[model samples]
Target chain A: MNRRALLGTAAAATFSGAMPGLVRAQAPGIKVGFVATLSGAGAALGTQLRDGWLLAVKHLDGKLGGLPAETLVIDDELKPDVAVTKVRAALERDKVNVVAGLVYSNILQAVFRPVTESGTFLISANAGPSTFAGRGCNPLFFTTSYQNDQVHATMGQVAQDEGYKRVFVMVPNYQAGKDAAAGFKSRFKGEVVDEIYVPLTQLDFSTELAKIAAAKPDAIFTFMPGALGVNLVRQYRQAGLASTPFLSSFTVDESTLPAQGEAALGFYTAANWAPDFPNEVSRRFVRDFEAAYGYVPGTYAAQAYDAAMLVDDGVKQAGGRLADKAALRAAMEKPGFTSVRGNFRMGANHYPVQDFYLCKVAKRPDGKLATETVRKVLSEDTDPYAAECRMR
Target chain B: MSLNLLLVQLLNGAQLGILLFLVAAGLTLVFGVMDFINLAHGVQYMLGAYVAATLGTLLGSFWLGLLLALPVSLLIGLLLEWVVFRHLYRRDHLAQVLATFGVILTVEDAVRAIWGSSPLAVPQPEGFAGGIEIMPGLTYPSFRLAIIAAGLLVALGLWLLVDRTRAGMLVRAGATNAPMVSALGVDIHKLFTLVFGIGAMLAGFAGALAGPVFAVAPGMGDGVLILAFVVIVIGGIGSIRGAFVAAILVGLIDTLGRAMLPDLLRLVMDASSARQTGAALASMLVYIVMAAILFLSPAGLFPVRRG
Candidate 1:
């Protein structure tokens, strides 16, 4: 064969490789980058968030709005640095139109600026720190979950209504933990006997439990998540603190209830949603989630499912044009999707303004543990930080 | 803190120390005798808890599960020693760290793949299920008391084995000088394997005991592993006596520091600021103690004398 013929054939092969890429760029599709702590102590929560989001995607037949969707799942490994690095890659390299799924506040804070500055929509499936909900609120950032303080504030209200004279507060030492303590204190009119701030990595709660016993408070309030929650609940029961009312948030939910078992039964937790919500959307979500994942869904999953719906509604309203940031932002502000929580709307700060429930751990007829909504604690509750938000 | 709270905190600290000692005893032995670093030592503790939880649930008896888990853990230790660890014995510390870290990732993923990411429920042994009255009003979990007792028993047994037995002497000699022991008509590799197996079993035992009280989930050992490392560093590597003393001391300091530091700081500062500052300081207490000890005695509190 001639040299020119050989060179022509090589050039044609290279052009053919480039042809599929050029054609795919013309197709109408949206890409989502889902980042969560999928491989450590917080893996269960991240797993729930991912599963719920995926289930919603599945229900929509792998399409968000009218466009086919491609999701790139990245495990943050529960590290802030890792989250920022991966999120930057998602924004710059993968060119994901939407960045979603962050279960921890620290991680969310780490990736928030990187994602929003890149002109990408950032949706938080779980973490909604007060930092983002207040004056630091961004037009590009929105959360399907409640503001960090909202649920804790619900518990504080319950304590006040119950007329607990003195309450002992315990929370992990971090931004969210501090927010939880503040939230609880903001509502409870009664005297706080003691406020214990344990390290986030602390799994054993013996010393804290002993202190609670010593203090002899009317009720004990704590906010421990993931493995920390599991250990605290079990130890609290074993230490015979069961007689003291255990009022908590994110401590005795569906994610930890399986391990907690009878130890967490009747424990009070405040949340915006539970697995046993009577709403049609929630009922369907819980039923399908259990059927698919072989475990009861938690609030994490519920919020993530709503996040997917919000994204779907926004995209649809924008007429599937992801590049139209202004239109997408406007559409997302008031997206018309029925939330699993029955009532969910974005407040001025882009955090959910919704009803919070005082839930109790209940055993299902099938012997699985789940949280049952006992009563509505807060109605149409907007975060306190929302008032400080400059965004209209 | 009141006298009652102090007593309870002391016991809690001891219980934590016992658990830490179980994990550290093996770690120190492995490090001292083999001159090898096993970052996956924490994985054994995790596995022990997993095995106990799964077996206990299946067998319908916590005691039986624990009894069986020890052998299974020992076997796992032996298996790992045979497969991954033996190959890396001659490698540098950095290589061992990298390789063992890989093992941790692999085992954690495998656990997640098999059991899912959720924490598993491990039932407490029936007799030790409830809290026992330590004082008139304050009560402590009996299961935790049992752990303390079991740990003391193990410590006594380890003391006997190390101080009085022929195999113990070899282990000590190996820790002091592996090459000299190997040249002096003794099978040093065999001694190293035995120490490794025992260390794995001890970690597993700690895990099984912890399973009932703590969350039995993937990466549960990672936090404890760091504490265990601190225990060995403070206790002196290869010294079981040092480990026991240092473990208890470390535990008491951690527990009491966390419980009282905020109140102490409250005397000087506002309550909220004190609580925040105290918590931050408490988390650093262990390392601070380690640093102080290391500064005072560069070889650690109970340094093994080198030949």
Candidate 2:
């Protein structure tokens, strides 16, 4: 064989029945591959996804099929190339019938092609990019979380109602960040003074904070999560520019709250759930998690826990049978389970049409980092992109 | 923009540049002297931040945390060299990168497993928390000004140490002629360990110092590592003076570019388009600058002991 042919042969060895990864007996079992950001700064979200899914697996005794099963989990590392490779391996080598767990919209986009081609059902735990909800929505692909824009829409409602006359918007240099700024604009009826875009994983923000300060807007709205949030809070506080109200989505949470401390005292963060949600499931999970992990679980963890419960309940409702792929997909569609978020239901886009809550960081009487449910910012919040979905 | 705001941003840019210098200094030297691509160097920086955060939490004093974290970081560096890095000394750059990459994975995972995924931070020392007036209307954060001072002092100390001390002479010699230095019966192994430890200590100190400014999170060092690599590449690996000059250049360019690029673009394009285009361009400016520098000078501005 020529060099190209030999290379192709070696590559073809990955998917052929003759490959070592192809297992005959486990073919009937539901092979669910989870694609998530498991490395780099993106690992924070992936870690939460892994924990939630693993917790679900533990509760279900590693059996998702109501029968023998195998779960193929690979770290996409939040890179496009990695996602494509992982998706191919999962479909060809692992022969997974179902795949889930995406933290970023971009990664979801990269892996969706391979997933759709293989007829594999993709259950996105997070990252409901607008495109996928409507015209771009493939029947084989479904989002388990809200569309990316819905979270920002929640913040927009709050901003418009709060009577903030002028605002400044900040987001990472990425698709969702742009969508977030645009999404906020969609519902907010206010003049935006400026928009600052920082690179993802940017730890220093004094310069940007200075820009926001100089703009002197009524409120500052941003969508930076995990480490980015922590950096922004510290820089904001240090700059002695605390008078301006700060509102954010997915930026201020248990993961970043500890780093911000008193600096996070008044910042308002929009989220679908808070640990303080007065529900048995929420309380139980938070208490158990704190007891086990010391730190309070973030909203990412909550969503993760919810996704697992949704899958678990769906599998059980399907007569404890995931033997058939279509039956499993059917069971998942009408998932009947209590999530950590409470009263969970999947929408037509295979995403959640859930309520968005405004959470403010407030120290308890004992002075530990805690968040209070300020109000339901947006009720029955649905992704704007879902209208484009033409599910076959 | 208000004069005070402009002054503060400028100070912030300078402070960031200094911190970059502290990190890039050791990285440049290690690559220059050892001819080893030590990717795990970033972890030492992260470990410094973590050590400081952990100690501050335990002792309730950020200064004490800073002092303790340095030695801990140094100890980690030594331990790493003894167990892992020492074996790779004779190997090529590929082996070193892979091994150090393993170190990064193991250390990062260990940090996550131990510290949990939540970000940890150390409070800025109260003594250094006050703002100082730079001009009639402008004031800068005391902690940040202190970083500039600390970074400058470290830079001077590094120069003196490398130029005036016997160990420094050996290192300078090693960078040029590793085999000859080893043949001279200087106990090259011990020297290498010492160099590695000091390099680790420098990175750690930088991390610990930055803990108050930046959140101590897992994989925080990855970005810094890339930037440090760029700095070393442009400054000439293993050259302290080169790293210093290059670090400041990179830092100033990055900070100023991010601040000014959009405005500059707005000159020709619409404000909104300019801002968006500027943001995308600003992100790539530092890398482009690095590539430009490398293209012009393959061995960097100051090629250490190599001719």
Candidate 3:
């Protein structure tokens, strides 16, 4: 009797699975494989991105472009090999129509080929590596986030405009870090006193901080992200180096400011958007995000919300015809939805041509720490690498 | 490097070494007395920081939080030994390693579930909030200096306890021959539990102290664990004195290498490539030194004397 009951259930399950495909053909639902670093030290950024994307979907009544949307959130664990393997599974096993969300550039570099080779619509919420922005640009790839180099370049321009003759630069020794150094140097034609590259896992910066004090440069520019930034900012102040102008990108942002506390106050960073962006979309996002997640939305969250909206608009424009790659690509290129960053458009390379802002860390009225926009630094700034991108 | 820079770097390295010593002391003792490869040892350090940060904020006093965390850490260690580690004591070394590694994963996940993955802030104590001029044109954080001094005090207290007490004698005997000590009618199991608890407390202490200076986040202990392992291996496994000397040596080498290698390489190569290669090489210096020391002395620099 038990065997007979099991057989009956199995037959019912097989029939129910077939029912989804039959229904899917009538109302073309979308499946998104959201891969991000949801665990380990970098998990904070990944969590923010994931939450932001989910919040956008929730705002759309749990559907993208009037179709039922199903998202499979996968934790990359910040490991390259793991990202490649899981992304492959998401593409092949799950047959996800769109792949979105990655926090680290290294992970993006690892999964880019497998994703693009399969001809899937890859929407990068963050980690816009310079390699893809330039000659390696693919029509299949699109980034809601600005190119990595472009944000770092803003700080470089700031340093130069402020008449800083000598600058001490520090970044993690990785592809993104190298790009940051190159980007900064492209704009600032000054003597770079020293460029210290620390390991990604390094939490202590006492030795490097010592070197900075000895050099006594006009300013210090760094690109340490996540916990690295947290430790560096606090230690910099503790070591009495706060007197030196702390110029950075992604180092003194909303995600890290909570841990950095008063140490990050008055420190400057450059980004495309902040929590205090003065617009209806951004204001609504910050208010809803804080109400939902109990934390201020950072740039990671803002960019990811844009990525989801882009996908939603793309699907809407394509009339839910996901299989038509060209139509979907064109729809995504000119995203119809209002961006949180008011003036945002896709560049020739599929990266954002957006205004950049110089932001300062400030304590909010409710005593929460967040980044506030100081002023606009670049208006409709396209990445330098776009000229090299010959997108087919 | 200039004289001022060198002096500050030295202090930084010494502070790092002191923290490594505190963590390694417990690790070495557990390994030596029990012959158990406790890969989960690092999680104790992480737990220490987490408990301190949470309680410190709650009670509004870093000192009170630190004081309360020690007993809590001790209780957690004892509970872990009773629940999980006791069963694994009779297991083989590979089994112990695999099991303890499982513990590390379980604890890391639990931490994330409870505290979330973001780093927690542990404010510096009131008195040690700023830097003091250690040398002309060079200032160091007083909190770091306090850490170094506290570590030294702990080291001295540990020495007195281990070298000048009856419990210390039993621990030495157990390290030499656990079976013989058992045969001599000592409660070997109790000794094992005691050593394990103490080791956990020491590691927890280090973590709590590190909270104000370093990042208090999940998996924060993993990197320190690797360095502590290196310290024990290079110091001669199971020797506190050896762990101390080796920890300081490793710390100085790592700190100085990172600070000086790039500048040194610039003399022979272009500045950009030199910085790149130097950063790569500096990270490798610790492991390279470990290999060299292991080659020179297979049992490490100061192998515990066996009867």
lDDT by residue for model 2 (A84-197), tens: 886898789767767888888888889888888877777888777777787887766766677777778888889999999999998998877888898899989999888888
Among these predicted structures, which one has the highest TM-score?
Answer: 3
Q: Extract clashing residue pairs from model 2.
A: A134-A388, A134-A389, A135-A388, B28-B238, B29-B238, B32-B237, B32-B238
Candidate 2 stretches with Cα past 4 Å from truth are: A1-40, A50-100, A106-122, A138-142, A288-295, A308-346, A365-368, B1-5, B32-37, B84-102, B116-118, B121-126, B130-139, B166-189, B236-239, B290-307
lDDT of 3 by residue, A259-373 (tens): 8888889899999999998899999999988887777889999999999999999999999888999999999888899999999999999999999988999899999989999
Structural similarity to truth (TM-score) of each candidate: 0.91, 0.83, 0.92
What lDDT is reached at residue B13 by model 2? 72
What is candidate 2's DockQ? 0.28
* DockQ-best of 2 and 3: 3
Residues forming the 10-long window of minimal summed lDDT in candidate 3 chain B: B130-139
Superposed Cα deviation of residue A272, candidate 3 (Å):
0.4
Cα lDDT of model 3 by residue, B196-301, tens digit? 9999999899999988888888789999999999999999988888899999988898998998999999999998999999999999999999999999997888
Error of 2 at A214 (Å): 1.8
Model 3, runs deviating above 4 Å: A1-28, A80-95, A110-119, B135-138
Q: What is candidate 2's TM-score for chain B alone?
A: 0.95
lDDT of each: 0.86, 0.78, 0.86
Error of 1 at B223 (Å): 2.6
